[model samples]
Target: MELPEVVSRSEWLVARKKFLAEEKEFTRRRDELNANRRRLPMVLVEQDYVFTGPDGPVRLLDVFEGRLQLVVYHFMFAPEWDAGCPNCTWLSDDIGRLDGLHEMQTTYAAVSRAPYEKIAAYKEQRGWTFPWYSSAGTSFNYDFHVTLDESVLPLEYNYRTKAEWEALPSGGLVQGEQPFDLHGMSCFLRTGDAVHHTYSTYGRGTDSLGFSGTVIDLTALGRQEPWELPAGRIPAPDHHADGCH
Candidate 1:
């Protein structure tokens, strides 16, 4: 019924110093990993993907919206689905209020496997204004490894698992393809109009809840009890986005 607190000033200092020294290794490794991720090889996206926007059909490159760099979050909002994926919902909640990302010369948008009508309905329900697109008509999902017939994620390589090893299900029982949704943000840079697919992935699906920025949710403020906004209080447009319509 109570949390024990008996550490003295000296004890606290020693413990804090120990924690800092131990955690420094982890911090250093993470920073190095991030640096390596930024340096990852850039490959030309040969596939010309098309997605439905608020108005009409648009090319994926158009999502850049003339910015030198583009960051796309493959949100989960497929037509057959009842709602967006929970993990994606977490990211979208953050994506909605980032107006300053544009100041960095980077444009961020979200795309879902769901069709335009479904996405629009969802957006209206959630009150989200970020440009949400539908990639139901193209191989964009597959190309990004987020739309597969089986949930076992693809595109893997390791000295232990061969050059092209397939990912297994979250649990042991593998069923349907859960094609990779490219969770988090994938960054791309355009050099002289010849766009280059640069850095990608903020989540990368590696750690479910490790990214500091991605974690630390404040529940006392946001109405998440029923996973919906307060009634009669201008609910988010996409929160009500349902595929049935």
Candidate 2:
């Protein structure tokens, strides 16, 4: 089986030191990007959208829970679906106790297009305690661009319009995927009774937020290790039989 070249301790240390320098530079770049993101201008949220929460109908401002800042995860759970999106569920599983956000005066909640009953039942089944609300029959999802329906609004995903997305070779939402739902996170700032949309990230923008995803991204062989073949792709006979070589 093929493996990373074996090296003496000193040689390995030399390579490790080089990689560490790169990692440090990456951290600095990330810090700069974060600063710029924070400086982004926000838009006023003028819609009077209401979402169904555990306490019944709650306005968009009420979802903030009286916090100065709010982060809403646009979970993809259509009203027709029996459960939430698996990818969204995976990320939700990574969420830890959110009490820390309260300490920072930032509230966190999840909004989905599914009905309250389905969301409650599924949340109970998954043992999740975070605040999740239903956006059914409202423009909440459409305004946020999570639930895509050309009839309601233009088709856009991850800042890419329908034409732009179709022009991509193999990325973004393809044909026949319209009127669909995609997952993302949106940040909002509350000033008195006004709520403003500060920032939103979709696609891979939200991928690295999870601990498991971050760890995997740090490795030389990322989540795309060769042994992990795509569906229907046959592996070679001598390929690492258990994929643990």
Candidate 3:
């Protein structure tokens, strides 16, 4: 791998300080964006979606656990599949403990199309403490646009249709395939007896949830993804070639 040019400590500090200013500006911009996100209009969720849990049937409101806010990770675990998606499992591993989020009046859980038995067994095997539920009998996944029907040719993902996913040189399965399930996160807000869909993000938008990626971004390699590298920066030989989009 190509290394950065050798520089004196004083020269390094000058470059670091300039980059630090840019980082601060980025942080400020992110804060503004977050505020705007919070201000986005919310739509009331009319569907009475029910999910199966380890205990018994759970209503959409119950999934909030009486919290003011709910964050559901749409895990890709089909009913017939023996296990959950490896990518979803990787994200689950980065979720860490949720007591802090709970303390702030937010509850986090994972929802999948798999049956309760399948979800329970997989959850136990992964040693995850966060709640997971099965939306097998409900249209929860479909309503959220995280699950596509087999007939839907060009699957919509990340808010766009990718008609050539399977035909691409990278050769990846499309979401339109059988056992259709996709990864995403949806946020809901509870007001009185009503729940409102606040926001949802799919694909690369959920990358911020992985703390490891944030740490990696601090290094010279910067995610080791071609798109993330600065212009003219020589990427590592083993950098990922496939783009997340």
Runs in model 3 deviating more than 4 A are 150-155, 162-176, 225-245
Better of 2 and 3 by TM-score: 2
Segments of candidate 1 deviating more than 4 angstroms: 1-6, 150-174, 177-184, 202-245
Error of 1 at 144 (Å): 1.0
RMSD of each: 9.8, 6.7, 4.2
Tens digits of per-residue lDDT for model 1, 2-96 = 22357899998997798798689978998999898788889887777878998899887788887778877767666687678765665565544
Give the backbone clash total of model 1.
Answer: 31
- Candidates 1 and 2, the one with greater lDDT: 2
Q: Write the residue-wise lDDT of candidate 3 on 7-98 in tens digits.
A: 99999999989989999999999999999999999999999988999889999999999999999999888888899987788778888889
Instruction: Report the Cα lDDT for residue 243, model 3.
Output: 24
TM-score for each model: 0.69, 0.87, 0.84
lDDT of every predicted structure (CA atoms): 0.61, 0.81, 0.81
- Deviation (Å) of 209 in candidate 1: 10
- The local distance difference test score of model 3 is 0.81
Candidate 2 RMSD to the real structure: 6.7
